[model samples]
Target: MTSPADLIINWDVARSTASRLVPPGPSLSPAAAAREVADVRQAAAEAVGYVHTITGLSAAEGLGEDQRDVLVVDRPGWSAANTESFRKLLRPALDAVAEKKPQLVSEGSSAQVFGSAAAGAELGGILAFLSANVLGQFDPFHSSEHAPGGRLMLVAPNIVEIAKQLNVDRSDFRLWVCLHEQTHRVQFAAAPWLRDHLMSSISTLSSSTLGRADGLPQRIVEAVKSLRQEMGQQKVSDQHDAAAGVPARNRLLEVLQTPEDREIMSHLTAVMSLLEGHANVVMDAVDDSIVPTVKTIRRRFEQRGKNRSPLEKIVRKLLQLDVKAAQYRDGQKFVGHIVETIGMERFNTIWDSPEHLPSEEELHNPDTWIERMGYTPKG
Candidate 1:
């Protein structure tokens, strides 16, 4: 572990702060909660086999049993685990900074202590906001003393709450959520190298972005202030801008990214688009014969997003979740187009190597990718 004196973010502080700030999930009796946990775990296990059948990607080939473990956790557990992953993922960048500027991380330095606390609170707040929204996640960077490699997490309370809000069949919804997350697990398990590739890309981007640490404190403060103002503003809605009541640019992206950072971000977003879209495709690929209520689940899910409270909508926009929502839509279209064009077997070739992955432009223009891959369109 990096010494406290040399760290930029105090992860312990982040975890505790998130725990304090995250709202309690829907109330459940002890027995009901216990049953929900069992049902979720079973659904996750069931999903693994279905994902393999639909996507033809298998984790059994390379992943260890522990790596394949599925966990059911509440919002707090999700926040704490993700904070630890964030720390690990960003460690390389932090280490480089510490090595280059020893004085900035000097032991017991008041500036360092305050900066770490502020950064922790900032990150913790973000996580707290997100905890309520995420249903499930397949974390590739997951590792621990007890388990190493990838793990799938189901936010039990989030799942229960969303299902109730959608008024969908609880059993069907649990499997539906797991299907999406399991596809992610299969994707990484099938391509073990992908984890390293992503880790390297993130580390490089982080190092480049955080290299200066100039006015780091002021930047953090302004960002938190801006975010609070945006989240707290009652007027912001999906149909209206936060301040001007006009279509607005994603200010969060603009503030955080330089040109070089944007380039990296573009690549990362394209990759995420592919992954998320592919998972979505798998979700719908399974016929109603399997999930029974798949169509209703999707319809209600989309409607729920459209009907979110104004505050929820604004928070999502500020956090760039609106961008993620676009990723799922655009990505699914791209995947659907490719599959229909070349068939799923041929489309599977996209997973053969990093070079085969579509660029952001290619995601919008599928034929370009087909042409680049040396495929001719059929009548």
Candidate 2:
């Protein structure tokens, strides 16, 4: 049997490489950095109240103030936090992989060292890229005896940089970002079972996929090559498709080996879409009275996607971030339709239990979910 150590990737390498590879965060003087952090903390605190009022989800009973505190971090800090999350989240799947392919780890010590380093470096690169782009995230998997509910994190420098790039009011942008992330915090807070449900679902699917991961590495290489080629062709054939990067995303999906894997992926996608979409809805739900530049922010943010450099676009496609963007749109449509048709109070039932969640098909066809949930059809 492969030892636990062998099953686990060398996360230290991942952390260190990410630290080295991640771009330095936007420039800020000591005072400016302090001010930004304070502002983010304040935004997060205020956002919690707005998210509660908008979504009707509050911190679960018994959550401590420590668990609810928002941590404001820079690029490297964000990278480190996510690295830990990946470690915890992937542990079970890696164990399953090791069990299925004991020799995969039982190779000579030199091979183990090289394999760990290689895998860590690859993950590190992805983390480094994402660290630059992510403004804020709520990590539900983080836990300790003192604070079992996990912490919310805001990447201060990235938020500042993106706001500058978008040429929006800085305070409005900050609060907008907080509103989205705070919704996520409120989500897990309201549905305490959600954390375990997601973790279980992810582990189950990941185990099966990793177990059948023959030719996985070759598939990844081919996927990238094909996406790059498709991107180039789309540049000549259709500028819109080139920017959208749909083909690349489809190619990436080929990594799943079975129908069951695809089903699991779909289910997970739907859940993510709901979470992301609902957050987006809540963020936008606040009107001009609160976020005065809300309309302008939304318009420019959409345009920012169309304005990425070719290299950044390629990176985004490779990371499946384009799919994440789609989730927001698809999910937003589903939530918006449901909320408009039935109202937010009725919409709250979706979070009542895992069974109440929408399936992938239901996301595209919100009427199906509504009907299945025993709601009256829209007139």
Best by lDDT: 2
Q: Pairing residues by index, what is the TM-score of model 2?
A: 0.88
Query: Lowest summed-lDDT stretch of 10 residues in model 2?
Result: 60-69
Write the residue-wise lDDT of candidate 1 on 1-379 in tens digits: 5663336788888999999999999999999999999999888878777877776655533332233368899999999989988888888888887777776687678978888888889989999999998999988898765445577889999999999988999999999998899788888766777888889889888887777567567766776677557757756666445574334355554455677877777788888999999999999898788899999999999988888899998888788798898899889999999988887777787877889888888988988999999986656
Q: Which residue ranges in model 1 land beyond 4 Å of their true spot?
A: 4-6, 60-68, 144-147, 213-259
Would you list the clashing residue pairs of candidate 2? Answer: none
For residues 1-379, could you state the per-residue lDDT of candidate 2 as single tens digits? 6445444478889999999999988889999999998888888777777877777654522222333457899999999999989888888888888877776676567767788888888889999999999999989999866448778889999999999999999999999998899888888877789999999989988888777778778877876776667666755344344555445446456543467778878889999999999998998799998899999999999999999999999998778788899899999999999999988888988888999999989999999999999998456
Cα lDDT, all candidates: 0.82, 0.83
TM-score of each: 0.86, 0.88
The residue pairs that clash in candidate 1, if any, are: none
lDDT of residue 127 for candidate 2: 95
